[model samples]
Target: MNCQTLLIDDAPAVRLQGAAGDTVTVLLRGAQVISWVDASGVERLYCSPASPLKGPQAVRGGVPVIFPQFAARGSLMRHGWARMRGWTLQPWDTSAPEPSVSLQLHNAVGDDPQWPHACVCTLTVSLLPNGLRMALTVENTGPASFSFHAALHTYLAVGDVAQTTLAGVLPEGAVLSLREPIDQIFEAVTGPLQLHSPLGLLRLEHAGFGDVVVWNPGPDAGLADLPPLGHTAFACVEAAAVMQPVALAPGAHWQGSQTLLSGL
Candidate 1:
């Protein structure tokens, strides 16, 4: 069957009326979300960009485009360039049983100065029977040093912050926030990373990632224009990067995936 867009609104105030081709239904009540549904197939975060307690917008969300250097790229903004520009979209492949869509973004020649490199990035938002999956694939179409980040800065809906205890491969001080930096790291994590939110139990699991960043903008951190992020109803539990940057030689490819599951 040819691909078509469908809008279905179920009970309990679930807004599933968004166009399937335009945006993916990642969030139900704005809070239970998989925001940053860009046409480029990248999903940013709905909560704070950078770690709030760490620094607002430091590296918050919007499919941060990383380049030659991560923290010291000195190119466009933090991370590198990617998310800063508009992306193009087209149908690719969704082999999974559940409905899914794919989008791609490439640097144009006229506007290549920003990145000064030739590369193609594709983000796929696959709606699986169980949950949603976002996959990022970066390919070097030019002859240049290339390495960027494709992360999902997740703001997990929670009840309380202080009472939350996280499990998983996180070290004692792997890092909860940038300001309150810690030097702990866990080798292998199997159970759910627990968070004691006033709301209820919050659990986070890292599937294909090496680092995890947990954040709570707390009362001390100022506010922004993010209405989806209820004052303190969310917690930023992310799959961190900062490892070996993908040094693509030409015609090279790099890919990564991050998944989020939610429940009270």
Candidate 2:
């Protein structure tokens, strides 16, 4: 395994390469996994070419880290401050078998005053032989207890979103295919899902999360960051905990993870 720091559009980023030839690149801006290529040279994560590489806004694609809030559920911004804040990279043992890296986020004085709660959030990305795994851990460091929602908003690259089918999380034998606008939240989802695309079969599994959000704005959503018809090349399948906000006492911690395996 190998790890290195490099620039992506002049922004700092870390790239980890596995012994098996798979690689994952994470940006320090959002601790976001912006790229994941399998050993066979298949790019599994979708990143918008029009999205700003460095800014207060979150990138349009990749696996974005959403914390302290989800979407417009609270007054703290669309997806909270985690994805917009810069993260500090944590040291890791290079001797470890898996090629993994971790970035840490903590609230500071005079940060977003809307939801002022001291906290520490960590995002770890590990590359597998055929895919990758992402884990998020949040710890309350303030004097008061706080409640929040979090998710790993993962956008998967596909040959054609209209030809993709997702199974296992929905009703038995009821696969989901996207052709139009889709925004559905499934509660208490504890099973793994299978995404069949024109490229191959991608397996998705989640841990420590109860909700799975499937979303797509369709071809005409007119998202500024996405190119024309960009929605048809990817799909969003997020592992989340949003139905009920997690209440953490001072010094308490919570963890959740999402794993994607290709050709499984």
Report the number of the highest-TM-score candidate.
Answer: 2
Write model 1 residue lDDT over 1-264, tens digit each, in one string: 124432323211111212333244322111123343333333424444333312223324323333333444355556455544344445534454545555567764456566577878775555432234566677888866665544445555444344444555445634242223122323334435655444444345545445555555555445554434343455565554555345677888877565544333
- Model 1 sits at a Cα RMSD from the real structure of 8.4
**What is the model-wide C-alpha lDDT for candidate 2?**
0.89
Task: Tell me the TM-score of model 1.
Answer: 0.62
Scored by lDDT, model 1 comes in at 0.46
TM-score of 2: 0.97
Error of 2 at 167 (Å): 0.4
Candidate 1 segments exceeding 4 Å error: 1-74, 92-95, 109-114, 171-208, 226-231, 262-264
| Clashes per candidate (backbone, < 3 Å) | 18, 0
User: TM-score, each model?
Assistant: 0.62, 0.97
Error of 1 at 40 (Å): 28
- Please give, for residues 136-214, the per-residue lDDT of candidate 2 as tens digits: 9999888989899999999999879989888876776788877667998999988689998887889999998899999
